[model samples]
Target chain A: MTRSGLRGLRAAALTGTLVLASGAFAAENPIKLGVLEDQSGDFAAATIGKVHAIQLAAEEINKAGGIMGRPLELVTYDTQSDNTRYQEFMRRVLQRDKVDVVFAGFSSASREAYRPIVDQFNGFAFYNNQYEGGVCDGHMVVTGAVPEQQFSTLIPYMMQTYGKKVYTLAADYNFGQISAEWVRKIVKENGGEMAGEEFIPLGVSQFSQSIQNIQKAKPDFVVTLLVGTAQASYYEQAASANVNLPMASSVNVGQGYEHKRFKPPSLKDMYVTTNYIEEIDTPKSKEFLAKFKAKFPNEPYVNQEAENSYLALYLYKQMVERAKSTNRDEIRKVIAMGDVCMEAPEGKVCIDPKSQHMSHTIYLAKVGADHSISFPKVWEDIKPYWLGEAGCDLTKKDPMAQYTPSNPPPKP
Target chain B: MDIATLAFSALYQFGDAFAFLVLSACGLAVIFGMMGVINLAHGEFIMCGAYVTAATVHAGLPLPLGILCGTLASAFVGVLVELLVIRHLYERPLDTIVATWGLSLIATQGTLILVGSTMAGVGTPFGSFQVGAYSYSIYRIVLFVAALAVLAALYALFNWTRFGVLARATIQVPHMAAALGVDTRLIYSLTFACGAGLAGLAGGLYAPTMTLVPTMGATFIMEAFVTVVIGGADVFLGTAPAGGILAIVKSGMTSWQGQLFGQIGLLIAVIIVVRVLPKGISGFVLRERT
Candidate 1:
């Protein structure tokens, strides 16, 4: 062999030893969990608690000896409530940092924006916000409550307590549109009539016409699926206009904590179906809230989304431990095996393998005249039945599609 | 419902729509219509007013006093803004728009950084009265009256007061007004201040009805701009009638269909008016009178 060849062989041998040493070192290395969420922007106020919750969950897991005796390291990015930022950060986290798993996206638009990128990288992610149902992706887990989970509990209670006639004012978007469809279906199934339905575009603050129309229709109650800060003005406007019809919503006081934010009687008599709220009066919930407050002393409220975010980390940790590996495919396989339950602050929440959605307890919370929240009723362990009914068996096949009422999977 | 009740509902809706348009637009009317500066920070000024009013009310002040404080505060800030930023960009209309837009972003973000995103909102004070099956807010009626009061106040300020005459002369013919021994610079500052104060007043009036947020100003901006645009440059001749017409179109379409259609109708009406008249409703009216 030439002298240059001997030098090359030595260099290769040295590099191989270094690689072997690093490969062993990798097991001791911290697991990188990417958190992509809106920390500052349009949805910042509503989502700040969520980010804090993730942080708290990570800290707790690290304190308790994280997944597989490896410390959990968070790689968080603020998407700033912008869709483009979601895409950019998703790619950065998955392709660049190569996070083991990502918990990202607040809005459906945001989720959809970064979802394709996740698929491209074959990445696993969790969307931890309540939304319109029917996202069946093999690479993602939806930890938030879907329409079937929320409306199935809410609409029936609304119809039973209030009357048969319903008026729905939904935000004009995918979440709102699809949720409105669910409202219609649930209302009809419960033998109730939809008096009027209006899809108010986002950023529409004025609702005098809407209030007037609601009065004209004279529904027993109004089902408001309004989203965003601007749309929250509907409650204030409706109160001022003295449209005294009891309002029921899946998205209002729970996520935004509108009752706590707005003054007395604005959200009075509002029936909100939620998985969690700051006012959840349970030992576990209180303990979790106290811990959260101790950590994030300035956080406004522990919203439903925050609870979902908090529990999602624990869920991920459980999957990692059960799978005995942080490999995405192994974790996904563990998820597909069946129920992976966790004792969440809200209640016992379990992951449904068939649809990659959660089955959890949902509460019917009512806002009193003084803006206090009270749980009047609750449905336990409500599975995400709509997707399964729509033939979205992720175990059978991953269509990687979102199904709406107008668009469903072909009947099996 | 009875015919009388139906008519009352329609009338109430018209008043509500008119109040919203006029109040939101009045400040922009003075800044954009009179001074020819498209003050994009108009919304920020409104936000300032709302924040101050809400904060003051929460701090144990009466609602009216809080509103007065909010207006004065905005006017003071307007003067400062005029002296610092707007004065430099007066000759550059497009630059003024950009500068004010920048100012708006800074104000919004600054408010966000300072006070966080949301604060507790003041409750709408007045009770509602039932007519047939429908109930309407008395505060909304108060809003309508406040809108008219604001317009009348503006009219009196411009048409009746000595400062109004000077402002009018200064805005219309600056050199002529300057040569005639008018302090044109002071007039410009005062006019801008008044415009901002009116915007603040709109914010104060509506603060009770809105969810007080850093970006709450955006909700008012679209209507304000459209109203000012359709009203034309002549604030006195333009704004009230423009508000009235737009209110009619908005309320008509709203009652005919829903708020979505109402908004669509308002935009469509703006398009048609801008297309035909080119200048605006006031321009058409001015031409007819001429």
Candidate 2:
């Protein structure tokens, strides 16, 4: 049979099933939640934990009899660390599995790839990653730290603790390079000079010279943005050289993976900014930690993406309970109107009324010699940098909200 | 600018990028030049090599053994490609490109379905042996030097060895070599495997610098195309050094200038050079003076 005929048959079958089960759909139909992420590529370690955590959340929710008497079904698709795969996965989830909600795509690149498709189909995508933010869409919610929230909170604190001079490094990509630009602005505005910045390719080695330059510049602190193991390698080189510059990272730089470079001395006294801590002073965090450890005891280390996905599913449950339906339009409306606040352990988080993003609290923690991410401080009231001073009003020229205007325009 | 500082800084950025680019370019050049097979699935061959290295290392195999098995298996996979798919497409360039591209997609998706969608990491098992001030991952530097050695050996193989001479003769005078009782058809398979083996070698070497993803092979393939085309696909020696120079300049420009402009400038340069010299400058220079 031809493909169109197969598609037609499937669509007809879908319509017939929906019509017959319309009355029982709310209670009996499986409310499929698509958890799509970079599964087989560069981001698996950071994101697989999230997929497993979401599964755990689903199982626990299902055992508790799910939201509003319906079973919470979780289906996962790995974007294979490619943008094209993300689109394909989204299609398979929406059309094939016919999921009600999805935690689709991580990283700014994947999110950008998914936004238009989600918007076109009138579905919802809860993006859970810290990014250089300038998002404007109703069907999307930015759960991770936007530039203003993550940078403003850390930069001033680092400057006060270390000094004004800062050195920057990041992966050479759309997200990392833009983030480095923001860090430079944040440091300079707070009475500091950017002492040379480096942008390594997506996967490059040999940081000897970048290390030497940063050491020679004598920067009081470093705002490192490199991700994956390159993030770990850069830190290892620095720590070994005894470059005691107080460092901060938007990426999960000094996690267990980085510390594994050598035994201990290679990755000590490093810091990272994230939303969830394995040791947060909360009952929920404690309970979640134990449960997560039981599930992922072998890979006991968890990153923010894992926590974000778990919380998102639970939040979807709460919203489903509050709204009393699985209507994508209604959920989209409820999220955009910002009437729902999750029982977030990091703190109570609600979607920003206008941006349609969650108001997540960002935390700064230092990795100790034993490889524990120690959060000594936390910042609430997180907002994007665009809403702050450096935000450019490009809405006029970019009336459709597709193009972005540069802040502090080009240096002649 | 102080040329030493500028060149040194550029070289610092250049080593990793060039190592990666040249590793694949060297392989593709050898295969395409010697065997005349398009081999679009070459990147996947490299990817399989890295994963084999990772899996073997994870399975409690020695690091050196893992590297050895990975490259051998990669070469084996190349032979498999030669046997299953490309064996028929020897005379069809477009068909070979299409078939290999499909194979690459299948391999990528198959990897996703089997291993998972997350990135797997490989490490240097022997640990680090650093010099005084300048530190390096012993494994990666070892790979870098190994790549050079392999290139030198390959050069000597083609220039000084009987197999190389036979292979060269097969290319230069296929009809004459066939009349002289040379098994020209067998050389194609052998050369294809050797080229794929080099890609695997590059992948195994690069496994430590960053995470190994199925898509990684594709990224390096793009670099391979750039280097191979610029270096002179027909000639191995001149193409590699020129490609290395280009890659370093491309990566180093991002540090001094910005990523966007640096890349844009590199693109423009590549376009202009290609326009003025279609066969590539290296190709023009490498041509016989007579």
Candidate 3:
């Protein structure tokens, strides 16, 4: 070889050695957590809170020394709130970004749509939202509460306390149909009869006629499964029309639900089955809230979306560490097995192994006079609570018990 | 709640939705029917109108004055469109549709790039009130009334004014109108501008009901097309209001039935009814074209 060629070869060899040395350093390589979601659509505000939560946890974890000493990287995409895009985007994150796990898929439709793709790619997904039931056998890990969290706990409590009859209104989508069906089943099981059921287009206004028809039904209470800005609009219309039954909603009637346009004083008597209430005053929650407020003073304190997003990131990092591998299937098993826990204020947040759904303490909160939700106690006996949590509990107690204590209490 | 309560509730629901149908359909019918341009970008025009109102609000103008200014800005934009790209594609309606559709995409994306992806709520023009078991959104009621007033003015403008006659003559026979010393191109340009302005005003009115989003135009555009097609492109100004009302009834009924499927099914039913009344329900009701 010529003298110049030898020098070039030596330089290339030196670069290769540096690259090898960097890879050999355990903490040098970064593991990516893809948070693919529609942070600006139907579930934008809600998922935004979750995303923020994921980020907060990731930051803290990295500061405390990241999973396997490798820092976490969070990349996000806006799914535009469509199921197809949601599925497609996550697939891209898995195939292209080669993320160890995805930390998103907000709605039931999105979860369902993305499930097959996750299985196809054999990638890990940490779902950070609540969904309808009876679906299991997915590689993904759901980290939010389930139908049991909302329907089994809150609906029954409302039925026994308020009345054994209720009227329900749901949005006109797959999530609505399944949610209403679950409500009907739970109500029937609890000796409650559904007085009436109504479905509205996702965000179309003018709900007066439906309100009037509902008034005629005169159920003990109203249950709304409305998603998006319609929640505020419905309450506004209902309050103005003097439709005065106390309400229990499947959706959170908080800041993200178009509070800028239509904050509701009528919602004073309203309640919802939420994973987190802004009023919860845990050290972690307070810190999260303070950090969130400091970041966006004008924006209302973080909603469930940001919280879930934040939690998702932590779960991804922990699962990856527990598995001791960035391999997708290993991380999937770690999350599904509920190997690690996060200090989620929503109660002991864990994924059910079989169903891949989050099993957490579900709450039935009443909207106080101050326009805030107050949870009386940690709610229990939420159905399909943990996807695999129940399956692993081979020896079981009375499943019919109204409220039971959390197996392993989340952070005090 | 009595049956009267329910009926009244249904009436109001129909009224408000009908306002959207009419207001949006006005633009859809004029652009599609006269120029044979789909003008899918029409909703973006409405969005621009809304943004104009927002800009006016940001400029410290009173709400009503802001809305009025926004409407004028929409008119100006409408005229600009006619003078520029849209007017050139009049003879090629399909090309117009495709080109305008591209414009719509560009405008919507441009909005996203400018304002933001966050949905911002606008101030409602009217306060709210309740009656019995039904509450009426004063803003929506105002929309219904405004749409009615605009429809009446449009009717008078077309049936009773020289401009309307000239426009009608040009639409019926563009070449013949030119021989009669009429400026067909100017008439077309004016109508196109009016349609575009109407769309913008709609955006302004709808702002309170929905937050501003770049892609919000897609939903309204589809709904507008359905309303226009079902109402009959000819004499759409009259049926435009009806289309809005019909959507209200259909959506309300969906609550009693299933979910969105019921809404889709009802839309199909409307199509069947339209087939039966080819000239439109208005022509069928009148027994003649007039």
Best candidate, lDDT-wise?
A: 1
lDDT tens digits by residue: candidate 2, A265-361 = 4446666677776656678778888888887676535666777777888888887777788886566556655567876757777766556556777
Ten-residue segment with the worst summed lDDT in candidate 2 chain B?
Answer: B128-137
lDDT of 3 by residue, A97-189 (tens): 988778767667777788778777877677666656545444555555667677777787888779988898887666777778878878988
- On TM-score, the leading prediction is 1
lDDT of 3 by residue, B229-285 (tens): 666645544355447546665756655554455457557757776778775555565
Stretches off by above 4 angstroms in model 1 are A1-30, A69-71
lDDT of 2 at B251: 68
Categorize the docking of model 2. Answer: incorrect
- Candidate 1 has a TM-score of 0.93
Candidate 2 lDDT: 0.69
Model 3, position B65: C-alpha lDDT score: 80
lDDT tens digits by residue: candidate 1, B1-290: 68999889889999999999999999999999989998989999999999999999999999999999999999999999999999998889999988999999899889877898688888899878888878888899999999999899888988999999999999989999999999999999999999999899999999999888888898889889998898898887788998999999999997887777888999999998888888887888989999
Report residue A79 deviation for candidate 1 (angstroms): 3.2
On DockQ, the stronger of 1 and 3 is 1
Predictions in order: chain A TM-score: 0.92, 0.84, 0.82
- Per-prediction DockQ: 0.60, 0.16, 0.38
Per the 3 Å backbone cut-off, how many clashing residue pairs does candidate 1 have? 0
Q: What is the lDDT of residue A186 in candidate 2?
A: 83
